[model samples]
Target chain A: MPIVDLANPSRFLALTARLMPWLIGATVLAFAVGLVMVKGAPDDYQQGATVKIMFIHVPSAWLAMGIWALMAIATFGTLVWRHPLADVAAKAAAPIGAAFTALCLITGMLWGRPMWGTYWVWDARLTSVLVLFLMYLGVIALWRTVEDPSRAARAAAILTLVGALNLPIIKWSVDWWNTLHQPASVVRLAGPAIHPTILMPLLAMAVAFLLLMVTLHLAAMRNEILRRRVRTLMLMQAQAAPGSAS
Target chain B: MSALAALFVREVRLAVRVGGGGGIGALFFLIVVVLTPFAIGPDLALLARIGPAILWLGALLASLLTLDRLLTADLEDGSLDLILMSDTPLELAVAAKAFAHWITTGLPLVVITPLLGLLLNLDAGASAAVALTLFAGTPALTFIGAIGAALSVTLRRGGLLLAVLVLPLTVPVLIFGVAASNAAIVGPVPFGTPFTILCALTLASLVVGTFAAAAALRQGME
Candidate 1:
């Protein structure tokens, strides 16, 4: 069987176990390099040191959105392919995605206070990200409220796919609402107008965040699979016991 | 066809009877609208400026008040299972139920908006625009809400969960609804543009909500 086969949870666990250490190492190394690169980068003429906040803020924002996208793909797996691990992957990813989203919002707030002179603005981009964060909470709440794991997974998957419609709106809300948040600079048609010095640390930090997400997601999935095993064993034990009905 | 009509009638009748404190989405709307002045003080100008938004928000929340019963009531009585088994496609049945919900719950909010507008001190034109926008926009709320209603139907306490899940999805409707009304009241922008988008949102939700709710109903039954 392929090492990355979707059918077998134990095989998936074996593969993740082998990959976990290297992933952790890479994450640590990337964070180190990213911090150094950020420190070495020159201050922006307009924003000064406040621009350094972007190193953390931008990557966290990216991961926040990226994780939801990953969950949506996993949703498809759960709904269409019935991949056993897909729900596990999504459920595991929600809190981490939510944490990253919170980090993104906080960092953006910190950055905004000095730059935009407000801790919060009802600007389109900011408002949309806020909605995305709420949507994440809603998904997590859905998962918790439903007692049946399979039913919870199915419901969560449907909700995730439905919520995916908002991603593009979040991305373009700055343009649409013409709010205070700056328009997309990095992914534009002209290809990243940001200076190379700033862009480098940004890319490095993004890679670091991605690695961190994977490391956390794998750990969560392992715990989930093990948790299921524990539940099954407990059920069997209760059923086999003589006085279990009482 | 008759099965769906009967279902629609049954839902509307339940909503009308149970809609107030026992069943009153419009009463909730009145309270929410009525309290704004007390909360914001007696600045009639400010009230007028913000009235459309207040009305839209009230309508949005009022529609949500009754959505939990959309499928849960049916599911509780095993009527949902029969609806699922019937020849009528689940999507159509879900759409019919949502429509009935709109008629019983959402329509009352729209009808009462003009009266509530008077309390907010909105002029006739502003009040008319808000009512028009709500009329076009509240269907989307009911439809979009149907999906959340279906997803949360099995839970013991799903009202808060339904609101959390459904509210974010309704942001676009709220935006365009308010924007369209705002344009009519105070705008360099034309009312037609945002109003058109609001209608498009209603149509889109009508389709997406039906299919998604049906899918959720099917999943929940398992």
Candidate 2:
């Protein structure tokens, strides 16, 4: 089907309904394989067992940032193209993205207690991620507070685009400031720093998380479309009933 | 006067009228500063050390206090619809409103900072440094806050939500503003470095905030 055909809510819903089972199956399969690989992966000579947290922590962090980038693109669709699903995609992505960001922070804190010897520090990486998390909450709150979906979407799109300014700052923060959080290892210009023993599982886990995010986002978008339908039906019913004008 | 200048003047005039919230922000700033010492006790050394941060935090919260009025007042009285229909580009008009808001609400905080600083036991030079940073930085706060104001203008009670939406975006300004003040007060790092970044942030936010706020206002009206 042509891409524009998916612009129809019913068509989009149908597509997601067909795609979800496969997506969920893939996500489960990927996680299973990723976890098994992670179990077999060697313990760090320095970090020891604490290194295992990276399997989850790093992927959540990636998705935390990656989801915002996805929303930014969806926002462009919202403001520029006025694509019907754009705002839905952006709105649906928010709470799920926020969950990943919170997961990233909590797991990082867990990793830090053993590695950095503290639950929290005002280091550049940590601070920027915290700021990212806060922005996610702000976006979600904006979504919840506005009663009108389209207006809320436009406002959120603007805010999301503006918030996108922080992405580069967060990405470059480790280089810009000599913070306690270590710099990029996996996706650096210098290439993968870790041996395949660890790198393979990290990649697998990241794929699994990406698939999971897609599945969850599609499910949320479907529910939102249904909710809007219910709202419209209820409003029409109220208007049709006698003495309901007041 | 030209349309933009006329709009700017009207905004400033409206802000100073009775119950305009022109002075409330500064009053809030003073109260925040005064309450700090009471909470932290009168350790002059400690106050002097952390004075700039408290001052910046006070200014940050104070600027937020009246932001809801930026567009909501015009929106409520139906003047905002007229402004929207006028030939003046919405972006420039929004910028003008934000500039006027800074003059009325933000300027008072900067002017009163040195006095508030004294209560915190901050010395003359330290207070001056903070005031200077505030002078350069608070416009960014107002402009950034404008986006939140415009976003929440239609909501019946948007004050707290506006604060939540705007504060995280203001983090960089807070960081650099405090860093510059600290640099001037006591620093191995030169004052020029972070001070320059703060000014740059203000400049960047001026453009970003204006455009984004304008876009949000236009979208909200529809």
Candidate 3:
């Protein structure tokens, strides 16, 4: 089994309990440090203060891809192992991915306006990210729409895995065709040779984003459990009523 | 065998015969196109600049309006159950439904794009690109929408949910469709890259989406 049976609810709770406070601390601490460093960095010789948005924009972009990939792993777990936690985790991760994607878009637009002289341009990278954002929204929407939980989870899992199709398209969109959004910098075919000053804060921001996502994912999984518990309780209450129909 | 085909045709015919105007889709499309000039400004130059993109966005939205009804009506009336039990595999049935759906909604948009293009002030080349992309892309719309439709097929009042689900999955086609047209309309970029990308996305969706929807339909039946 690729996944050990993880349905033991106490184990999930125990794991999240141990992980949550550390994730919360790491995220808050890193955000504070990263913010200070970004604010203190000397203005770019070329773009100046507006370029500062890159600290936020780039990290969100990294997490947007990272979270989608994480969702794919969860989806694979559900589809192959029929692991119950996998469905909950994938469902839990979507809104966070959507939030990250939206953050990426807003920051991109802010960064673009000064650089491109337009708030929004339909460049390939921007357009592909927008597509990815919509994909996140769609998967979340489908998960909520269905009445049967198991079926919805399976369908949404399938979609999560399938929509991973957009990842490479997004990464390559700038290079694959002409676009205003510049191609990858710290990440490139050549690899990370970016100046250390810029690279260090960027790495810190990535750590912050990862920790934030993990905290939110645990919160969301907790929420799912509560929602299901409530649903089950309501079912029991309805059944208890003398005239209730099953 | 023909009876299965007939049932599929009946679904298509019923949709057309109920015809409230086909206007909701076209009107939604026209309204989106119509609003762009006001919102983006009366610059014919700006409108012309973004025209193909506006058209592609409008077409994708218009196509979505038809999806809520794609599976709901049949599932409600119990016709879907009979189709499930019929000799035709659900995949073929789905492919047929998708074909019929394209005929009703997508085909009209494809036909009317040229007329709409003139209104948007798109030139001859951009209009052709719009037509070509719409032709290639809407079948993907039907197929993708079918899966969303199937997933929500069992629910009452599933329309808004349908939009939320399908819109994201359809984004690639929307991006490439607009890009293909935008390339020719907007600049020095070669058109072939986006055009080929659009074709590949549509073909991929046609295969994967078809199977997913078929599996969903079977699940619904059982």
Candidate 4:
């Protein structure tokens, strides 16, 4: 079937059911390979074993930012295209995105304790990420506080799009003001700065994390659809009952 | 009067008559600034050092305090529906309301900052520096708060929620406002750099807040 056919909720559910096992298997396999690679990779001369934390920390950080970008696109789907599943997708991604952001923050603190010799610093990258975490919570709170899911979704779509625009400005302003965080080494013009031996495991772990995020997101979307259906049925039952007030 | 000017006058008049606009925000700003000394002790040097930061924070919060009424008052009285169906564009209408809110609410906080700065032991130069930044910066706060105001327009008890939603987004404005004031007071770096960025942030928020709040109101009113 063409991809657009999956816009139907039932069709989407069927596709996810069919795709779930393979996705799970791949994620598990990827994580296994990544862990083995990480075990064999030599420690950094300076950081020693502490460098191993990068495998977990970096990927979660990537997912933290990546998931927001994903939600921004989903928000566009909701607002512009009026795609039925788009709001569900955006809503589902929020808490999962929040979890990854929290994981990123916690793991970064763990790493920083050894590297920066403090649990936290108001470094540009670190502070911006914390702001991102707060934004996620704010969006989720907006979703929860509004009684109607559809209304909340539209409101959240606006907030998400604005956030996507503001995020770059926040990053730039923070970087301009002060920065103690390390500069980009992986994505810079000169290319990957690390030796391939370490880079391989990092890439593997990143893929594993991506797979994990997708799996969780799809499952969460399915759950939200089911929950909405149950809500519809309950309302129907209430309306059908005897002596119900209009 | 032009349609936008009429709307502007209506908002200012309503805020003035409604009894929550003129002095409430400035009073909150004063209390917040006064509380700082009690919380942080009466050390003049330390208060002088952090004076700009305190003033910026107080203005940010006072604007948020008054932002909830920006759209809700109209929405409650059913005039928002009338405004929505009117010939003037919603974007201009939202901007007009926000500007009125700044005049009645945010402007007072700016006018009172120098006096409040004295409570923080700020010198005359430091007070003027902070007041200047607040003048340039609080419009950004009012506009940013407008987005949250519009988003929460339909909800009950939305003020606290509006604060949560808008505060993080105002970080850039806060950072640069305080930075510029500090730079003006203690000048290793030129004040022009941060002050210029502060102005840019206000301009950007004016465009962003107008469109976003208008969009939110459109979605919400349905």
Best by DockQ: 4
Interface RMSD of each: 1.7, 2.1, 2.9, 0.7
lDDT of 4 by residue, A1-246 (tens): 998889999999999999999999999999999999999999999999999999998999999999999999999888998776999999999999999999989998999999999989888988889999999999999999988778889999999998998988888888887889889888878789999999999999999999999999999999999988998899899999999885
What TM-score does candidate 3 reach?
0.81
Runs of candidate 2 with Cα error greater than 4 angstroms are A170-178, A244-246
Report the lDDT tens digits of candidate 1 across residue range B31-147.
998888899998999999999989999889888887887877788888888999999988888898899888878888888888999999999999999999999999999999999
How many residue pairs clash in model 3?
Answer: 0
* Backbone clashes, each candidate: 6, 0, 0, 0
For candidate 4 chain A, which ten residues in a row score worst on lDDT?
A: A181-190
- In candidate 2, what are the lDDT values of residues B45-135, reduced to their tens digit? 9999999999999999999998998998798899999999999999999999999999999999999999988888888999999999999
lDDT of 3 by residue, A1-246 (tens): 123434754577777788888888888998998888777766777887776787888889888888889999987777788777788888888999999999999999988888989999888878778878878887887787777667777778767766776456544543454466555678777778666677787788787787788889998997886677788898889899898665
lDDT of each model, Cα atoms only? 0.87, 0.90, 0.78, 0.91
Models 1 onward score TM values of: 0.96, 0.97, 0.81, 0.98
DockQ values of all predictions: 0.68, 0.62, 0.34, 0.85
In order of TM-score, best first, we have 4, 2, 1, 3
Q: Which residue ranges in model 4 land beyond 4 Å of their true spot?
A: A244-246
Model 4, B201: alpha-carbon shift in Å? 0.8
For the predicted complex of model 3, DockQ is 0.34
